[model samples]
Target: MSEQHSGRRRRPHYRALSPLREHLRESFWFAPLVACVGAVLLAGLTDLIDREIFAEATAEQTADTLLSFASAAKSVVSTVSSAMLTFIGVVFSISLVSLQMAAGQMSPRVLRLYVRSRLTKATFSTCLATFVFALLVQLGYDETTDPTRAVSVPIVSTVVALALVLLSLALFVLYVQATLRLLRVPHVIDRVTRESMQVLTAYRWLAPPPGQEAAERPEDPPDGPAPQGPVLLHEGRAGVLRDVNIRRLVRVARRHGTVLHLVPRIGDFIAPGTPTVLAAGGTAPRPRRIAFALNVGVDRTMHQDLSFGFRQLVDIAIRALSPAVNDPTTAVQAVDRIHQLLAVLAPLPVGELRHRDRDGAVRLVQSVPGWEATVDLAFTEIRICGAGQPQVTRRLTAALDDLLRITPQPRLPPLLTQRRLLERAVDAAVPDEHNRAFALAPDRQGIG
Candidate 1:
């Protein structure tokens, strides 16, 4: 039997909606656009309700009472409509400042956190919708010359507008609170760690457990020697390879009687004319079809890139340790989170990169960073940058020691290697033996 027919499929392989969904999630406009449309429709409905029910009902009430109600409601709606514009301006102004501070103080990549915030989107959308709803309600106010004429006071619209105004006020408070919390280093670090943890969970599911990996591995060349076919070059704009349509690639390869090997890993930058896909075996698949199976975007997203999370955390740590910042405590805090993420990743079988169809033939092969590469990406920059800071070095040493205890024997070398390099760095950077010894000591809290 062919290798394709040999092993059991470990996880479900399906096309992801990451391209469209990720774009929409990260965009600041889509949510508000959807809310405004809904608000407009709601405003129209309230106007119809008022014209049909309140217009006739007002005829039965005294003229004095009707006039008073209409005047008061119109006053309220007008105030809310005008004030909502100011509210939007203030909210977004503060948001922009927060983004600027986060970019300068932390990593520019963390700006995505603010943009992708649901509270930020909700607050802006609610303020916008409230303004639209109140403005339309203000227009629905009807005037008449004669006492006998029925007045189509916007009673329903006024009530709905008031409710929207209250919602806006509530969301504004929540947004401000959230924004304040996000500005603090600990909160920001925790949020990034949580997101990375989610990505780690997804990765664990995609890759099989350690013992099962070899048994579940698919045959690479099928029957004969490895065949190499046409290479598909990247076309169009340069971008980071964000995701792969693995299922689609597998289907295409299976149909063509070929094995499709993706040239770039997730998070790799792809320029036009770069080799994207390599076909081997039977007939060559269409280059356009193969390219469509990949999602390349301007920025690296956490959707499928494992290293992106590590990249973000490391960026924050190094930025904090920079001389301009001189914030060693912040760097130590970031290292704490990094240690947590590494703990979660230490034991997993994270190397699986082959995709096979139902028959068990390897249809797609992609490259992924292995354990050593991940360890280096996580530690090398921080180890060098934070070498002089005793707090950061101590914290890093503590983390490495903890990881060494839990990591399998096979994975121990990378952690050991990082430890050796860290010691050399500390010895060279710190001239004083007492400070060097202090930095060498493993302190999980970095001296607390």
Candidate 2:
């Protein structure tokens, strides 16, 4: 049976949305600005319609009653508008402080997580919308010198403004809860783990089923008598390679009748004039065309970089194990989560680095880290940093044991080597036989 037939049927692959759209979606300002505009319009419409209804009131009693409430409504809206402004300042200050604390205590990259948080966006939007609504309603109130021409108070708009105040209060409570959650170490670790898992899922390759002949992996075109000279594409600017338009690159290669070799992976940094790709074929695609297919950014993003997830978790673990922090339990938590992620990756064939065209011809050749690299990225640093900490060592040992049990035979050698290294570290760091035994034991929560 063919590899494709032996494995699960592939799902329909949809092209990712453009980078600009993704950025706007992840931005903190866009959604809140949208909410502010919507609130302004809604307040304006409500004021206009309510004012008209008051002007057209046929009953003298209703007109007099509404007129009596006009002054009070205006006063209420004015006060709420001032209060909402104060609230906005306070909320923004709190958010900034929370971000600072998170960056100082945890990984700075996690600040992006807080920035992209829906709860934070919703809270800010609600507060801003309330301020705008109250301000607009307050401005619409007109106390004319002539009684007959007096604008009837927009009772509906005022009431809605009051409701917004209440909603803002509720959102404040939620914001506090969310900030607390974000500050918690376990919550932060879990969030990073979930994000890393998502990246892993998106980038994982389907391996052929057991006993089925594996698919012939695509390799770079072999040197030939008429070998095309390698074309070196240089980077135009310095930044991290955040994403790559693989399908587009494949199309570009197929168009130029060439095999494009990408020099950098998703998380690599390339300075200007650095060799970025080596094109080998009849017609090399324009440098701009190749560059256009790559998305470079000031910092690494979770968009296509799987190692970034591990980098984040490892950062948290090492930070937790640091002398200033001295929180081995948190480190253990991070290792456990890393172990969970490794379990998911253990059986899969990682680092499938070839992109083929529609005609089954190799078009794009890119480098991807295999299982061993990923495992090393995930564990090696934590192991070295947390070597002296018994709790971290125990958790690391347990994690390796768990991985060794689930990982396929070909992937075992690395896990076994990691296990031995961990044991040696335990022996060296933990002198007491009892403590060493405890550290070597596969305890999920470490020694504790």
TM-score of each: 0.90, 0.86
Span of ten consecutive residues with least summed lDDT in model 2:
218-227
Q: Give the TM-score (vs. native) of candidate 2.
A: 0.86
Please list the C-alpha lDDT of all candidates, in the order they appear.
0.82, 0.77
| Weakest ten-residue segment in model 1 by summed lDDT | 1-10
Model 1: per-residue lDDT, tens digit, 128-214?
A: 999988988887677753445645677778888888888988998999999999899789888888888977776665564456565
Q: How big is the positional error of residue 415 in model 2, measured in Å on the Cα after superposition?
A: 1.6
Off by over 4 Å in 1: 1-18, 55-68, 145-151, 209-212, 215-227, 356-361
For model 2, what is the C-alpha lDDT against the true structure? Answer: 0.77
